[model samples]
Target chain A: MKVLVWAEHEQGALKDATLSAVTAAAGLGAVDVLVAGDSAGSVGAQAAQIAGVEKVLVAGDAAYAHGLPENVAPLVVALMAGYDAFVAPATTTGKNIAPRVAALLDVAQISEILSVEGPKTFTRPIYAGNAIATVESSDAKLVITVRGTAFAKAAREGGSAAVETVAGTGEAGLSSFVGAEIAQSERPELTSAKVIVSGGRALKDSETFAATILPLADKLKAAVGASRAAVDAGYVSNDHQVGQTGKIVAPEVYIAVGISGAIQHLAGMKDSKTIIAINKDEDAPIFQIADIGLVADLYSAVPDLVARV
Target chain B: MKILVPVKRVLDYNVKPRVKADGSGVDLANVKMSINPFDEIAVEEAVRLKEKGIASEVVVVSIGGAKSSETLRSALAMGADRAIHVLSESEVEPLAVAKILKGVAGEEAPDLVILGKQAIDDDSNQVGQMLAALIGRPQGTFASKVEVEGDAVLVTREVDGGLETVKLALPAVVTTDLRLNEPRYASLPNIMKAKSKPLSTKAPADYGVDTAARLTVLKVVEPAVRQAGVKVPDVEALVEKLKELGVA
Candidate 1:
């Protein structure tokens, strides 16, 4: 059986999540990988080292420098017709590209897959990450985007995969990227961050959020996340949202501030290695799973935390 | 330009969902059902395009049991010019949903199609991409920002490492991300106006499609619960404890 995995990248280097995606694709067939990025980027060489990948297809150009939906969907669709299954990471890029590729191919795709039983079957989460659901995909080309954090990174001792080029033509009609203001942090990216400090409604405003949460994140070199209530209240942008409707994170350390741990909120961060919750409500559900529980007002506890940290 | 938007009816996101006692599926007996949040964003994007003159007409569609009409109503209330309800009780896999939409596209020939990156209920972000492929159209998924210029669409997308931007041709599929746009609640005036907007219902058979569950729900198990742990009164004590636990 032939399989293909979409290698997500930025500026030319492969994102760590792509390795896990390749691992998921390997379960089905003899897997090959493909990356769309700039010509001078390291993603091609980086992809060449994944253990199970037999070949890596590079569609590198100025237009392809950024894996845009337009350039990627067509190339992936055109290349994947020869494979029985295709895989991509469950990151934002894969989520955007995988669906379009499946749509273009006229095949079923299972997203946020936790595991693969065979060529076309996958196990994934449903109901706000509360329940596990197994699904099957039919048609010659079955595609899926894997939850990357579930698997370990690719080891460097594997045999190298040959790199090939896909001469993709044309563009997708829609949207342009002007510029982005990334969350200014010297910390690891959220999914990859070992430490995560998240805020909730307790944060009265952005200033308070920055004052307390930023220090903790900076001290631990962690990522900053927010509860759904916090995002909806506009204390933070939706990108920082962590919940059933937002991002599901599994960092090594998760700190919840002024947050009541609703089941939905906990579902996203329950996988963290260590959970610490600070809230004025002693009976808050967050305390149930918190490895460290601090019962105090956020306004006072926050400054105290900053001084101590 | 004509744009199509697809939505799904799932347990209202605000409503906490729990597994059924029989170990069958999530209990929906009395839980409120509404359009999935991500799909609401999709519907909103389509509506915004129409409202802003980037799109001339918006077509909203959905496939499920009779109750899914409620989701279609949300689309109408949001601003879709028309609605198509494909009645099916069987769970529609992403591929089948794509096929049904493909069939509709053959008849409607919309310029672009948009849907949620993934439905919060199923957490499957597949239909949009599968449909885009089925129609042999380019696709942009998880777009934070989408702009229509002539026949090309430029999209700014969030990524794992950071953000990246790309441009696509028309007749593409664009799945919405969280930052895409805030979906406006349907007001009383628009809700009343939606009562007159055209919402037609048809069976999956009418579209020559057999709506069967391609993917079976083998089991539904609640995630393992986690318990609380050590708490230190001071940072010095906490730092010492962390060192003792080998996590500092």
Candidate 2:
């Protein structure tokens, strides 16, 4: 099986999720990474070092900048003849592009597969991770999105994959990039963070949510996350939401403050290696999955814990 | 300008789904069903566009069993001008649903097509992009803010990092994300009047699309349950446990 993996990069460096995707692709068979962007050559160099990658296909063009699905999908479809399966990280970019590629190829897409049972069969979570379904696709060419949290990252070095430049498809002229308001954070990205400190509605307001959560996150050098309730309540931006509908994170240490632990919230972080819950409500469902539970008011407990840490 | 919104009926967000004893699939025998929350937001956004005079009409569509008409009625009550109910008793995957919508769009020729990012049931966020690909139009997925500016729609998308805004030419597809808008409840009068609104029933064959399962389900099972662990007594003890675990 020859698998093609889309390389996701930003600011000239490959994202860590792409490494996880490469690892997932390696499971199927020989892996080739596709890096398409204005600065694809540099990103291609980074993708070449990933362990188990056989070759890195670089398509450098101005039209491919921003990783627009309109242009990217067609590019993937153009190269579909040499590969039997296409795998991408189930990030926002991958989700946006993979479905379009599948539709263009007239095939069904398997979204966010958790495991590769066979070449054609995979297991994925459904109903907000309430159930796992093992599905086998009959499509000739399989299009899949891998959940980065489920796969281990491929080693970043010790590979000598050859980088080859591929021709680019010009502008699709359907959509244009206007502008972006990317969040600036010094801490680790949530999906790649080793430790995450998440807040909930009990933070009362945005000011308190930040004031209380930031110090603790900073002390641990962890990424900040928020429950859907907190995001809906305007305690934080939508990007900070960690739930079934939001970003999934499985950090080494996950600390929940003031969260009641709804099923949706647990679906995103239940895979964490260690879970610690701090809520005054002793019966909050979050305590059930927490490895260490502390029944205390977050306002007092968080500050004390931060000082101690 | 006219807008098309595709809604989905799914298990109520509040109810926890239970896996069947035999593990065929989620038991939906007696579970409460409602319009998918994101689709409700999509309907609300389309209605708001109509009220703002940017759109002349808002038409909703739902593809499922006869019960899906109930979901269409809810969207109609939320101020949609009319609805199209495509009846199908069996499961329809995202790709087939997108093809059916493509056929509907060809007949309707609306200025914009809006849908939920994903149905909470399958959690497959694929239809909007697939429809765009099939119809040869631009797509704006995970849209938190949508603005119509004459010939183009400026959509602010909720990405992994933050918000990114893109400009798509007219007659594009957009999928709604959370924080787009707070959906309004249908008033009593609107609910009563929606019963009189125009709703046309069609079949997937009418669109010349085959609704068949392309993926065979080997089995369904519940995820591994996480067990509750030791509860510490005090802050110092919690800190001690953390140190013992080498996470602190």
Candidate 3:
């Protein structure tokens, strides 16, 4: 089976999430990475270095600059010939584009698959990770989006696959890019971060939340996350939310402070290798899954822990 | 300009679902159900637009069993002008659901269509983009902020890194993300009035769409459980444990 993996990138640099997707794609069959963006030749070159990639397809056109679903979905469909499956990282961009491609192809898209049981069968979490469903697609062509945290990142530089330029379908004339406000942060991205320091509503307000969590995060060089309650309480922006409805992260070390460990929050971070929960309430559900539990007031414990660490 | 919002009936968010003993699927026999939280947000957004006079009318639609009308009624109580129920007993996949919604859009001709990014049950965040594709229209998905300006709608989407704003011409599709708006509960008077609201019913065949399952579920199982670990007595012990683990 031949599979086409959409290589997600930003500012012409390949994203690590794409490497995880390439690894997932490799399990299915021969992998071809598609890097589509204006002046993204370097991105294609970077994709070619991923181990096990058979080829790197590049579509450098002005219309593909913003990675809009209108432009990218049709492009993927146009190139779907001779490929049995199309895989993409289940990032925001992939979630936005993959279903359109599936609809255009008249097939059901298997989303956020955790494991590839077979060429046409996979397992994915349903009900926000409360259950896992193993589904087999009957469509002639498979469309899939892989959870980046499930698969290990493919080796970055071992292969020397050749790159080829593909024609792009310019401007679907449907949507226009306005502006973007991307958060600039020195810490690692939450999904890909090795260590995460997450706060909950018990942080009280925005100022206390930041003052208490930021120092710990900075010391560990970890990404910061917030519970839904914390975000709803206006302690942080929605982008920092980690839950079933928010970003799912599986870091090496996860530290939850003042979080009551709601089921929704556990859906996002339970996959972390090691979990540490510090809450004043000993019965807070977060302690149920935490490898290391501390029943103390986070106001003082977090600061003490940060200074000690 | 009219707005069409698609709501879904899903297991209530607060309920923790249980896998069946036979490993067939989730046990929903007696589970309480509610409108998907995100779609409720979509309906709220549409109603707010109508209140702002940006939308002349707000219509809500759902494709499911007869019980879905109750979900539509909830939307109506929240302030939708009318409702449409595409009756189907069996599960409809996202692709087929998009086809049905496309047919509905063809008939309704709404200026904007808003949907939840995904259902809490299936967690398949597909229909909005798929509907946009089937209808050949622009899509602004995972929207946190939506505004109608002249002939176009400016949607601020919650993307991976931060937020992105896009301009889509009229008759576009949008999917709601969190932080869009706090949905208001149905008032007692509004609930009473919603029973009399116009709710039209249609069939999938009426739209010339085939509601067939393309994917077969082999089995459903619970995820691996994480075992609770030992509790550390104090901050010093926690730091010492982290140091032992080589993660500090």
Candidate 4:
């Protein structure tokens, strides 16, 4: 069985998550990494170097820069027959394109799969991570999206790959991108960050959050995140939200401050290796999963924790 | 403009899901079923659009067994103008569901179509894009906010890197993400009002749509259960335990 791993990139560089996905695609069978985009050439070269990858397919076009279904769906569908299984990082790009390809090919998709079972089955979290479900696809071809961070990223460099360009007129849609406004930050994205410091409604306001949470994040060299309650309360932007309805993130160390740890919030961060909670409420659900729990106000505990680190 | 919201029925998030002994699928013998959480958000958004005078009517649709109409009621109670039930005797794969929805689009000609990002049951997350493809319409998926402006709809999507704002022409499809909006509960008054709302039923034959499963579900199993970590006495004990395990 041949597997195709879809690599997503921005500007001129491949996203590290895609590399993690390639590492995961290793479990299926002989991998043929497929990189789609105008600047996909750079990403394709990286895929060929991955140890398990037999070859790499590069579909490059200037029009493919920003991932839109109009372009990616047809290209993936056209390439679907060449492989037995397809794997992609469960990023927005993967989530958007993989299913379209699966639909076109008339197959079911296993998304955000945490583990593969033998050859044709997978284990994925469902019901907002409250429970995990196992799916077995008896189809000839299997398509899956993996949680990129769960796998070890393979680093095999110094090689090249054959290029294959897919001709597609982008989808006729109601919307077009005028521009993008990225957060002006140096820290890694919250989803990809190994150590994350997240604040909840307990932060009180954005000013307190900046003064308390920011310094602590800086001290830990961790990414900053917020709870859904914080975003809803206007204490943080929606970008910082971490919850079932927001973003599902699993980090090495998840330090939640003033977060009561609602079931939805826990659904997002419960998979972290180490959980530390700082809250005045001893009964807060965050403490149930915390490796370190300080029953003190975040206003008092945060600055001191930063100093200690 | 007429709006179409595609809702999915799944195991309620609050309840624990049990796999069937035979592994056919989730054990739904007596489990509580509800509309997929994200679909509720989609339904809420469509109903809100109508209430805000953005859409002329909100149409709720579902592609599943006869029981799926219960989930459709969720949209009706939330303020959808009417409902369309596409009952399939067997499980319909995502691709086929999209094809069915595409046929509905041809008949209904809705200006906008909305659905949950992924169904908790299958977790395939493909129906919206597939439907968009079959209908030959642009897609703005995982959208947090959608507003109509002129002949286009401005969509704010949750991309992996950051928020992306895309403006698509009218007659596009958008899928709701978790952050889209908080789904409103149906008050007792609204629940009563929903009974009077129209729910039209149709078979796949009526729309000339196929709901066959190209990929068969051989079985479903419980995830490999893991041992929850034992709690240490305190922070100092935790550090000691970490050191005992390996490096402190």
Model 2 ranges off by over 4 Å: none
Model 1: DockQ score: 0.51
After aligning candidate 4 to the native by TM-score, how far in Å is the CA of A276 from where it should be?
2.5
lDDT of 2 by residue, B1-248 (tens): 99999999999999999999998899988889999999999999999999999999999999999999999999999999999999999999999999999999999999999999999999989999999999999999999999999899999999999899999999999999988999999999999999999999999999999998999888889999999998999899988987886766
Candidate 1 chain A worst ten-residue window by lDDT:
A169-178
Q: Which is the winner by DockQ between candidate 2 and candidate 4?
A: 2
- Alpha-carbon error at A91 in model 2, in Å? 0.5
* Candidate closest to the true structure, highest lDDT: 2
Whole-model Cα lDDT per candidate? 0.77, 0.94, 0.94, 0.78
Q: Chain A TM-score per candidate?
A: 0.91, 0.99, 0.98, 0.92
User: Any residue pairs clashing in model 3, and if so which?
Assistant: none
**DockQ, all models:** 0.51, 0.87, 0.90, 0.44
For all the candidates, what are their Cα RMSDs to the real structure? 3.1, 0.8, 0.9, 3.2
Alpha-carbon TM-score of each model against the true structure:
0.88, 0.99, 0.99, 0.89
User: B31-135, model 3: which lDDT tens digit per residue?
Assistant: 999999999999999999999989999999999999999999999999999999999999999999999999999999999999899999999999999999999
lDDT by residue (tens digit), candidate 3, A1-309: 999999999987789889899989988999999999997799999999999999999999988888899989999999998688999999999999999999999889999999999989999999999999999999999999999889999998998999999988889988989999988899998998999999998999999999999999998989999999998888988788898888899999999999999999999999999999999999999999999999999988999988998
Residues A1-309, candidate 2, lDDT per residue (tens digit)? 999999999999999889888888888999999999999999999989998999999999998998889989999999888999999999999999999999999999999999999999999999999999999999999999999999999998989899999998889999999999998989999999998999999999999999999999998889999999999999998889998989999999999999999999999999999999999999999999999999999889999998898
* Residue B96 C-alpha lDDT in model 2: 99
Candidate 4 has which clashing residue pairs, if any?
Answer: A38-A61, A70-A171, A173-B138, A174-B168, A174-B169, A175-B167, A175-B168, A175-B169, A176-B167
TM-score of 3: 0.99
Question: Residue B37 deviation, candidate 3, in Å?
Answer: 0.7
- Clashing pairs for model 2 are none
